[model samples]
Target chain A: MADPAGAPCVEVVDLHKRFGALEVLRGVSFAVDRGSVVSIIGASGSGKSTLLRCINYLEQPTSGEVRIDGEPIGIERRADGSERRRSMREIGRFRRDLGMVFQQFNLWPHLTVLGNVVEAPIRVRGLPRRQAMELARACLERVQLSEKSSEYPARLSGGQQQRVAIARALAMQPKVMLFDEATSSLDPELTGEVLEVMRGLAVDGTTMIVVTHEMGFAREVSDRVIFLHGGLIEEEGPPAQVFGTPRSERCRQFLAKLLH
Target chain B: MGNWERLVWNQRNVLLDGFLVTLEICAIAFAVAVAAGLGLALLRLYVRPLRWPAIMWIEYCRATPIYVQLMWVNYVWPEILGWPTTFYTAGWVALALQSSGYLAETFRTGIENIGRGQREAAYAVGMSPLLTFRRIILPQVLVTIAPSIVTQFTVIVKSSTLVSVITVQDLMFQSQRLVNVWFEPIEILTATAAIYILFIFAVSAAGKALADRLRLRYGLGT
Candidate 1:
């Protein structure tokens, strides 16, 4: 269901995160509509990854709200009508709505490609083994790695491993997909292979929030580009406006550095 | 010369019998140690409220000598607690308790050795903490620590000698009895040492073979 403002599938309100004495996210906020691609770009340590992590509740926000499908996640309204952090069990239920891909392609080393893809379905979702395997095979085909299903993750190349990771998330069929620098660990030549799978997902209207440093992909793929600096939204708009006009000094400087 | 050979050959059955009992104790104690060690490690790391209790148990068990622990469990615990425990029961239980602390340390190391990335990957797919531990974290940790665990088991077997002090009639106890009966300390004790060496070598080789098989199966690098 849509919120009063719009049918935003993902919403962040005044997110603030602190790691010990240091603050990582300072009053950050954004929204992503269903079936739209939004790329969040920033310099390292600007909290781009933390922002994506907060949305998926990977890193709990210090203060703020994350709403998925218009429902507040990882939080409960108290008797006095103030939000408090939910228990881990409660947060876990909400987490099922989103799928995330990571920089390291963290596929289970001992499990085969198909086994990695089907693990959550059988264990978390309690799907029968045959059904999970069938779904896993389909996901592998989507990522163009059906032939690699029996291979262990360690046996696959970096790009192939990342694709298997994507298929793993796809088998869950989540409403929102959060990518935390999914290609950052890969070599430049390998990054394109993973980006290609993501490009296909974007064309297919998957609701995605990508934290990336790839300027060309960010400019060409995202419906909107968000530029973050010092843990705040420096600028945000359609790719052309954000990329062309550059509203803020931080955005201009960040883009100038990224382009080169 | 013929009498020495006859005595050595005759004692083989007795040694084999003692070996079975020793093996049984090892198998049971190993199972108990793994379960308790895993629980203790989990308590120290995850169950924050029980951290002190887990730590205290691990430290207490690790600090005291195994032979002393065996005597306490066999001779003192029953009287103090007004409970009855056979020497055999006391033997394995004490062994399980003492080695469990060492095994717990290994488990803690294995658990911490896994990168946060594996945990996040499981969480990303909406896995509950329980599921993550069951499916992802524990399995990898077990594989990572298997060789260490096998080495620990070897230590456990060697320490099985201490069970003789509690009068459980394990291999060492049987060897001592044969030495007394035959009046041949050098002959029978030397044979006992040989037996231990043979058993330990078999165990280590089996452990290496298991590791090799797992390495191939998981495609783990050298």
Candidate 2:
């Protein structure tokens, strides 16, 4: 049942992340509505990927809270007024609701494309093999990779491999899909195919949080765009507002370098 | 009867029995080596309390001679522990104990060869660590080390000869017995060496076939 209080599908509050002395994310926060696409754009080393990682609990925030469906992620707030990280089992179960597509398309190399897509449903969800295979076929079809279902990841082109990865994530039926520069590793010529699949998903109203440098995709497909600079959100608004008329000097200069 | 015909007629069955015993020792020792070796590798890599001890034991086994270890386990261990130790038991125990270190090193190397992203990908799919290890990591490890394990198996087969010193009546012991009885060291030794070569070559061939099949099935390489 939907909460009457109208909580967003994803809420990240005052997130901070540090690796040793290097503070990568400094108090960045955002909320994502149901079935909306948000893109985070920034220059290299601007902490956009870290922010996405924190949202998925792939990287633990130094101090902050993330909520999925108005429930705290990975942390149990006890009556003793101390917060403790949930057990690995709890985290794994919670993570099933969020699918992440990596830049390297980390498909299980030892399995066929269908096997990669069906792994979570079969292994974690305990779906029957017949049912899982059917679901996998549908997901592969969605990505236009039905022909490559029996093939291995290495046999596919970089674009095809990434599309299979997207299908693999889609098989989980996650509440939100997180793309950490999904197209970054593709050849310049091959990036468009992967982006096209992404655009199709966006049109179908898939909720997504993409950390990317694809400025055109952000400007065209995303409902909102967040511009990060030096571990902070320098600008955030509708894509037209943020991309057309960036507010911060840092964001403006970054955009100038990127657009030109 | 001709001399060679007489020798073959008298000694063929004895040599066959000895060859069977050698194979038995190798099979048992191989099983021991694989199980113990995998345990040692995992303990050294993951189990904190036993890590140092596993490392030290592996180093010790790799450092000392198997011949000496066999002698010690056969002769000294029983006295120290106040237990019975037989020739059969000693040969297997000593050979497995020594070779497990090598197998452990092989496992560690294969495990290192796997990319970190493999585990991360599994974890991202909401798999428990146990599931991740079983489904994601263990298969790759088995495929990676299949050839090395075959090489080790052949070595163990040859090392079965060491048991002859303790009167286990394996291939070497029986062959030496035939030499004493017949006084035909050159011919008998040549035949024995030929048997060993045949056995080792068969094992290597079978291992290669199995490895190739696995690689192709897993879509690893040509």
The DockQ leader among the candidates is 1
- What are the runs in model 1 whose C-alpha is more than 4 Å off? A1-6, A77-84, B1-4, B219-222
What is the overall TM-score of model 1 with all chains considered together? 0.95
DockQ (C-alpha) of model 2? Answer: 0.65
Find the 10 residues in a row with the least total lDDT in model 1 chain A: A1-10
The interface root-mean-square deviations, each candidate in sequence, come to 1.3, 1.6
lDDT of candidate 2 over B1-222, digit per residue (tens): 465566654678988999999999989999999999989999999899999999999998888898998898899989998543688988998889888999998898887778887887777779998899889888889887899999999989988899999999898899899989889787677778889999999999999999998787775533
For each candidate in turn, the TM-score is: 0.95, 0.94
**Candidate 2 residue pairs that clash:** none
Q: Please, what is the whole-model Cα lDDT of each candidate in the order they appear?
A: 0.88, 0.89
DockQ of each: 0.74, 0.65
**Candidate 2: true contacts recovered, fraction:** 0.62
Query: What is candidate 1's lDDT per residue for A145-190, written digit by digit as tens?
Result: 9999998988899999999999999998888888889899999899
TM-score of B chain for each model? 0.94, 0.94
- Model 2 stretches with alpha carbons more than 4 Å out: A1-5, A79-82, B1-5, B8-10, B81-84, B213-222
